[model samples]
Target: MNTFLNPFHLMKRIMLIVTLLLIVSCDGYQSICGLVIDSETKTPIEKAIIKTINPKFKAYSDKNGYFEFHNVTGFIFSDNDLTVVISKVNYINDTLNIKNGDSKLVKLIKTE
Candidate 1:
């Protein structure tokens, strides 16, 4: 049987195209990393919460104000934008939008 004229071959080709299309259509996840700091003092804020919504998750900033949500759970599927909220005691919460392997420096203001 001519491969191109075979029914099974046609079905396989169609299936391959459909699979590739689905994969291309999806907005995939990525690794997110950043730092949280005090707006006034320009110092790192330890133990600050970094997170997202819907498929919610929370990560804490280390003593150096560094935080990371690696590709595994930190996966965000949007228009290449991931919004994360950062909060800690005595500090006003802040939000950050990280994109495509981009890291950020988030500064939170202190409460009076």
Candidate 2:
């Protein structure tokens, strides 16, 4: 039997095409993720506030010092760089110039 004429084969091909389209469309959004750490100790810094300056998206670092902004569309189609600021109570604030779909390791200096 011809593959194109087979009903099951045709259905499978259609499904594959739809799946690929969905995957490609999802690339329009960006995810920003990072780990906040102490500059001197090199340890994870909990309760750190991470935010983007332009689009005003904010997230707090979890106990493991992991923070993420998911499906962020701001600046995704723009040429301007995304600025991220991380700050904690005793740690000095840190800023990073990041792009869409970028992950970074931010180190904050401790305040005396």
Candidate 3:
């Protein structure tokens, strides 16, 4: 009878520990920012598509080629584990891997 009671108590303690971990881990969340520029001219390209493979996240570059990915939460984004595919109407597509929890600068070159 005592052995059976011990398992239930242990399970409850494990669940409580997991719950506390979830709440405290939220403090490590971060956002990302960057700019997209033309590789040749060093000019910024507006409305370029920026995409992440994990979580299937996507954003568009603004007129100044500035992009901000906000509140991107997940465990898969640890330690620079993101891949971005940048594209525009006339430019060639470019793919890059980025570090997590930090800003990045990317340039996409256009080909005639």
Q: What is the C-alpha local distance difference test score of each model?
A: 0.81, 0.83, 0.79
Which portions of model 3 show Cα errors greater than 4 Å? 1-30
lDDT score, residue 69, model 1?
78
Clashing pairs in 2: none
Candidate 1: segments with Cα more than 4 A from true spot = 1-5, 8-11, 14-18, 21-27, 72-79
Question: Candidate 3's residue-wise lDDT over 1-112, tens digit each?
Answer: 6864798888998899999888767534446778999999999999999887765789999999998776666553246456778888889888877666577878776888
What TM-score does prediction 1 earn? 0.75
Evaluate candidate 3 by giving its C-alpha RMSD to the native, one decimal.
3.9
CA shift of 11, model 2, Å: 33
Q: Per-candidate TM vs. native?
A: 0.75, 0.69, 0.72
- Candidate 2 residue lDDT tens string, 8-65: 9999999999998776665355578999988898999888999888678899999889
Q: Write the per-residue lDDT of candidate 1 for residues 1-112, one digit (tens) a residue.
A: 8999899999999999999888767655677788888999999999999887534778999999999876534323444567788999999888777775778999899999
How far off is residue 109 in model 2, in Å? 0.4
In model 3, state the lDDT of residue 27.
Answer: 38
